[model samples]
Target: MKFYGIVVFLAFAAFAQGVPHNGRTKRSISDNLETLVESIQALASEVNEDLGIPAFDPFTDDSVAISINQTLAKLEGELTDLNIDGLSDFSIDTLKFTLIGLKFTFAFTWPNITFSTGYSIDGTVASILPIYGDGKASGEITNLAVSGTVAISVKNSYLYLKSMSSAVSLDDLDIQLSGLLNNDDASALIAAVISDTVPQILVDFQDVISDTVNTAVTEYVDDYLGSMTLAELLALIGS
Candidate 1:
């Protein structure tokens, strides 16, 4: 999910800055931000390909790790050797950006997103259910919304992401885990419990997600912007 957000953010950022390419019209700096965003959205595919931004539809990760802590379910464990897929097929219901000083707030909603993963978890569910196995997990989230504030800083005329804070919420979620337990009923029950609890868990651990996004985005954006000279950047935007 974080990776998906990062790609989308960078794609818009690149388009807004008017990264130059062959046969593309240069955008004037005097154009309003709203107009620029509209153009970006319309030309998203073209710009993403031209700028070499990672595709947002159908994103995948070969390996990931997540810690599970659910007091209500009495679940405490870790998911390792996890492979995640299907982050790209989403509809952007809304995307708004507000800029003030060196800070900007970005709000967006993905109407629907479906994903699947393979994982191995060692945990205890419902206090009595021992969950230790390798399995496949699949789910869909409805109305996933995110709002974030980003602070930018300049050093040696290069822009860097100084900090970021974000909040995430979803209207609904459904998940299923298979091959975790020998009994089908038990596995289905566990899956139901997870589906119900995950939304709240995301809210509880939002800070961790924000910190991770900040670190990763800052490094990537800083490196990318630093590679270009101020003059080159300005030129791209027709300044």
Candidate 2:
């Protein structure tokens, strides 16, 4: 029952830290982003839990839509310009990130075989690349350890930083719980928690969880902490 365990997956961990504006430095973007990461991680788990769909219940279709809408709203509000660029360095190509998007919507319209629904921001962040924006005055995130990509574009004063991740895996979680319960009843107990509703759930909630996490990560890299420093940037960040 490794289903309850943390599955390893590739992430867009690219980010920036020290930010310089008009030759002066500000806060560490990486540190602030870490906070966002924490929130996304927790939320992803929650979404996975809510994917309780029973084929017998076609009504689950609408509920699924409502859930996605709710999640999108939460993500959009979370990063209302929280200056993600300030926390990023972009010093290298394929920058890895833990946080940073757009009005990306994805749907899995498979017939009688899949029920995956998702959306993406935009851009790619690698797990190894490090980079910073051009200009000598620009500061960098110190000790900025990352794991994925943080890609963004500037349009109409707004920074659309989106994170993309794939390469994922699902595992068994019954290992840890093995001893918690007696030998006779332990296996069944673990199976019940990790098991899904027959054909209703397949490949687990990995995609849904990944998308939710991606949204949060994208928001983290699109911070507006430094926006207060400039009116033009502020307006952009607010958007």
Candidate 3:
């Protein structure tokens, strides 16, 4: 995400400075634009290395609780936590994200982001009656993918990435349970419980997730851009 913002900043700086002031300048503007695109791609790759963003990495969320009420199941509990490795399957190709708005003219338009992966989680229910008492259920949601458009804007010379809209889609959700609720059909009941509850859970925490993402982006961008100066930036472009 930090690299994503820098890609725009670098392109803006290059375009702003590379614009010809006099009729006599021999360099073509297209050449500079072309070079800017290449530099952004190269720099983004290096930043990924510096950030140690592996091709496949795990993402975890530990503090998520949701309340549920449905005809099939009525439950109150937290998602407890989740861990899913091999996130590389969800990784959007750099080109897909970069090429969409790499042109200098499209700097103000936000780019699209997409991700796909499978994740497993534990659910701790304090009260889910009829079917069982206090217990925990484990499950995995496979073929999950999310896509959205992010809006990036500058205010007071500081850049901000805000999630304007997003959508989540998944293929299969399977759950297995234990602790007083264990049965031959435990998985189906657990699945029904989660299916009814998870969507509302996401809806409830949407703003929190958006803020967290924005805050992380702000921190990373501020650190990455803070030490850079106008002259150094120009040097980077020219070099």
Q: Pick the candidate with the highest lDDT.
A: 1
- Model 1: pairs clashing at backbone N, Cα or C within 3 Å: 56-88, 57-88, 58-88
> Cα deviation of 159 in candidate 2 (Å)?
2.6
**Residue-wise C-alpha lDDT for candidate 2, range 15-95, written one tens digit per residue:** 111122333544333433343333333333232323331111111122111122332122111111111122111122121
lDDT at 152, model 2: 46
Can you write out model 1's per-residue Cα lDDT over 69-114, one digit (the tens) per residue?
5443333334443433434334444344333445656666767777
**Against the correct fold, how does model 2 do in TM-score?**
0.27
Best by TM-score: 1
Candidate 3 global TM-score: 0.39
lDDT against true structure, model 2? 0.28
Q: What is the lDDT of residue 184 in candidate 2?
A: 24
Candidate 3: lDDT of 208?
Answer: 55
Better of 1 and 3 by TM-score: 1
Evaluate all candidate structures by whole-model CA lDDT and list the values in order. Answer: 0.61, 0.28, 0.43
With candidate 1 superimposed using the best TM-score fit, by how many Å does residue 189's alpha carbon deviate from the native?
A: 1.6
Ranking by TM-score: 1, 3, 2
Give the Å shift of residue 18 in candidate 2. 5.2
